[model samples]
Target: MIRFENVSVTYEDATETALHHVDAHIPEGELCLLVGPSGVGKSTLLGTVSGLVPHFTGGTLRGRVTVAGRDTRTHKPRELADVVGTVGQDPLAHFVTDTVEDELAYGMESLGLPPGTMRRRVEETLDLLGLNELRDRPIATLSGGQQQRVAIGSVLTPHPRVLVLDEPTSALDPGAAEEVLAVLQRLVHDLGTTVLMAEHRLERVVQYADQVLLLPSPGAPARLGDPAELMAVSPVRPPVVELGALADWSPLPLSVRDARRRAAPLRARLEGRTPPAAPAPAPEAPVLAQTARLTLLRERVTALHEVTLALRAGETVALMGRNGAGKSTLLGSLVGLHAPTSGSVSVGGAAPHRTRPAELLRHAGLVPQEPRDLLYADTVARECSSADRDAGAEPGTCRALVSELLPGIPDGTHPRDLSEGQRLALALAIVLTAGPPLLLLDEPTRGLDYAAKSRLVALLRDLAARGHGTVLATHDVELAAEVAHRVVILAQGEIVADGPTGEIVTSSPAFAPQTSKILAPEPWLTVPQVREAL
Candidate 1:
């Protein structure tokens, strides 16, 4: 259904090619997963299939890319719309309409389908994606997860033969991600639809993939094989695979069930041993931020409701929950983006909402979910310099942080041209340059690979050790387990659970990391913990 023959892509004025001599064939009805490290051109490869690389992105494409037997070189994205549907990393950017129902119908309308067919497809997609109740709601009011579903439903309504999704489940909760993957599985098995997805969260999708495509590095030949075969040598791997490797399991387990079945001996080895304890703040540590009975309403929706919380110095707290569970709202309240309806939010003894921008930066800094929102300069150098000036840091401080967080990103490269993970690293460096007492990161690891995530974990740990309080709102259970001292779960604008990371993650199946799940009843939340235990 999809074929790339001697394909290589290079952006305008770019030194490195995004993809080099890539040759791969994805058969009809197969769910092919594109896996690689951050900035390795996974997105670029996906764009080629939809004719977005050289066509809309102003790049040079050599060789051929054909989808459903149609040459992408001759067809633009709009021309290939009927054959390929692409949903990018940012769902908000994909929406062209205001309401959920309108968004779903927009694609079909663009294709000039019969009104009856459009309506029928819209209804069918709404039901298939579990968006029935939200069909009449405005797109902006929906939670991040809801917006993701709408974005996907919009593309699926057109009934395209090929679906190209970039990080489709990045913003979704575990349960919601499963639902989306299930729909993809149905499309592949029942309808013989071709699905090509690029995702950083391999643990969630690897098991479902019929074939795996590994892009080891930018400008390198792509590898195609069975999931287990590719995973065995892939630099970036899911936690389950890592666990299987650590335990010397003959064949690496892709899914939790398979891993658990092979974990009987490993489980017995750790039966009585306790997992290492996570670090904790001192009992007398000062409070860096506090929220008392906070309530926030947006467009008549109670985003946050009478929520009380506190952040202590030298502590890293992870805020987790399903989509629309108010995790972002809580971060907004702390960062002064949203004012509470009924209660108070204090950061460093001053109200965040009333705090000046300069003052707020000194108190706390926020790296929003959309990393581009905080980036405006044309070049990476300028952005880093601006961050230094804004944070009153040394001239090269921000640049140095960027190097530490994301190396190999050229200083002269346009911020817009960077990959999602590289952009996030730059944004994070901008925030960290301030050296604020409190750090706020929302979904910080969205596009990061395992190596980048490990670097971020180390950075967060160092910050907490230096008495900087950190609050991370994320759907990454693995990240929470790695860096979070305490995990706070929110649901429907209320705090549902708050405790130590080990305690909170192990108690809930949905929120637990792969290591915790594999070593059930043992409280091991990470591979390192398991390794240390043995």
Candidate 2:
């Protein structure tokens, strides 16, 4: 069992304690979920189990953290490595080896395991994770999902009694995310390994958690208990739970399947009432931007090849393809971050490359996939206001816009100190506050929970309603289906498919929705949508 006895943790160079006298226990062989809004010390709490908080990160640690009956303070990461395996938000950050086989063996080899044992464990993990086919492949060549699995497999090869994963699926598409989660579920059910995970996207994993730890805010204490109880008290509850609350159901459902099971009676009662009118069809989209014979050259890579497309106003366009299919590069080319090798790209009738970066802020705003790097401000409020003022926005309007985007952030908190999700939200707020006519978002929902994602979707929908043209490049097909009017698939630096979101997702095997793979023929994005659809 892992036990935290009144553990209060403060990072170096920070005034506030990330964890506050937190007492928690994660029993051996139990799946524990550490969940919270951005920057509530969930990651810190997980770090304690792996001896990373005070040992590796140089934090002020109080109280005792005991794992597998060993005091964590006495055990360094390598000393406790065999007992506890940790996977962080960016899986690629930890990799030291080139191939999948070497990665899995690295951990075991460090533990002084025999060559035979390492080889056997490596092969076992490869087969267990379905990486046998790609065992010899370079880590750089694997897809995001594949890389994440390899990371997990590498850690698990040590045969740790406890596995701690921090937002493992945040960077993956829903389909790929589901695949990773399935492997984790198998580890718990089959191997009886205690799985403790901290994630923002609760809707995807909440159903699998045996226990839930809900952290309210940064510097605040966390509450731990039953999943249902945690959800009941959580301010950032999933839409399915919210729908259950609205339906007045006792003991809210955690999964869509559970919600469906309970909604039969609720549906019968709701069927008695008159249903609301169908939503008006979205306005016919008109071309707002165009790329004619566009080409992008990135060192030795040809990111885009003679790509031609039109993005219409009031249209939500999603760019979908496997990683390295040049999704990020294509989006970069659109914003002049990567100047086109040949041909022209125009936004709102202005040439993309010719427009100054500051001038482009008036016509288009690009939210890069990795938004944390975009933030350099001291405080969240200041950060949000900085870009808007740079773009000549009114101070009041900028504040108003920031408040709308992140209602959770306090006024004076340091922007750099905010959690990854909150920082992403802050970056998006900075871009949106500029009030650009064309908005480009690359993987906007990477580290957000269902509540945050819904808020983002609603915000984007409102933006589209207000006539802003939004282009979202993402692996999230669910997000695409709900918000986008059209889906554009890019493969091998060329446009493979472009059409209506529903048509593209529902009909194409290569471009199908991930949510549909879980619960088919539903045509829904949220649990509420599923409930309503049925």
Candidate 3:
């Protein structure tokens, strides 16, 4: 059991405490989920368990933290390594080996385990994560999702009693994410391992949690309870499930299958309801920002083939594909971060590769997949205004625009100090303030809650409506359905499918249909659409 008795942590060089005087207990072998908007010290709480809070990361501490009856204050991270294993959001930062097989065996080898036991454990871990095919492959060559699994596998092979994971599925596509979750579920059930995970993607893991620890916001207290009970009160509640409850359904459905089952009767009752008249149809043959035979090469690999595509003005396009299938690379090519080897990539009648990085900022605004690397300023407001200075725009205008998107935070606070959701919002506001005609967002909703996602959808929809072309590379099919007018699927660095939102989602096996589509897989991407379709 992991217990915190009035534990409070305050990092040096910060004015406020990260975690308040908090008391919580995680029972043995319980699949406890640590959830909140972001930054509410969820990660800090997990760090305390593994001796990261006061040991690796120096911080003022009060009270005590005990794991399995062992006092955490007495044991540093290296001392607790045998009992606790942790996987952070950034997996690559913790890697100790170059290959998957070697990485899995590194932990056991460090503990002085015999060669035979280490080999067996490595084999078991590889099979558990379904990474046997890539056992000998280079760690750098693996996709983001695969790397996340390898990180988990590397730690799990040590047979640690407690496994702490931070946002494990934030970087994964739908199919790959399911595989990782399945492996984690098996660990809790079959190995009797205690799991404590902090994540923003609640819809994927809420049903599996035995206990939910909900934090309100930064520097605030956290609430703990059964997963289902907490979901009802959560500000970032899952969309379909929340809609089901709003519509007065009995025993709220947690998964798509359960949602379908619950909605079946409702569909029958509402079958005869008349549909509202259709709104004026958008123009046929929409004029898109055309890319004529675009080709890109990264060393020997072809990042993008001679691809011809069109992204219509005032329309949202979802760019979907397997990881390492060049989703980010394509976004980079369009923003002049990477020059194409052949052909041309254009946005708003100008070639991005030919334009200067500063000049390109005016035509297309890009939000990279990893938001941390993009942030350089000390404060949130300063980060937003950095773009203004770069583009020769007024700082006052930039501050006003950022305030409009994210309201609660003061302009003087540090950007890194804010929650993950808030940081994402701040970054997006900066990008949009540049007044670009085209926008390229790569996994912009990665660490956000449902509430933040809703705000993002509204913002993107408004931007598209205002005649700004938008392209979003994302794993959240649900977000794509709600905001995007069109969907394009990429496989092995080539366009495999492209069509309207409804058609591509329903047809693709690689893609999991959105909740709205799962409820009603035709002519719609929302709950209202499902209700009306019935």
Residue-pair clashes per prediction, in order, are: 0, 0, 0
How many backbone collisions does model 1 have? Answer: 0
Stretches off by above 4 angstroms in model 3 are 13-16, 132-142, 217-221, 269-288, 410-414, 509-514, 521-524, 528-534
Residue-wise C-alpha lDDT for candidate 2, range 1-534, written one tens digit per residue: 889898989877666777887888888778888877766687788888899888887878999999899898988887888899999876777899999899999998888899998998888788776778778888976655678788888898888999989888766665567767887888888888999898776767889999987787766677779999889888677656777787787798888778777665655554433322223225576667889998877655677888998876677789887665777777776677777788788877787777888877778888886677678888777775677678677776666765665575677777655766777788888888778888998888877766677789899888877778888888766678678877898887889889877668877644554344334444433444545644
Q: How far does residue 153 in candidate 2 sit from its true spot (Å)?
A: 3.3
lDDT of 1 by residue, 148-194 (tens): 99999999998889999999999898988989999999999999999
lDDT of 3 at 134: 79
- Worst 10-residue lDDT window, candidate 2: 272-281
lDDT, each prediction: 0.91, 0.77, 0.77
**By lDDT, highest first, what's the ranking?**
1, 3, 2
List runs of model 2 lying over 4 Å from the truth. 11-16, 97-102, 123-147, 216-221, 266-286, 292-308, 320-326, 337-345, 348-362, 377-389, 395-400, 407-416, 476-478, 489-534
lDDT of 3: 0.77
> Which candidate's lDDT is highest?
1
* Candidate 1 TM-score, C-alpha based: 0.98
By lDDT, the better pick of 1 and 2 is 1
- In candidate 1, stretches whose alpha carbon ends up further than 4 angstroms from where it belongs are none
Better of 1 and 3 by lDDT: 1
Assess every candidate by TM-score. 0.98, 0.82, 0.90
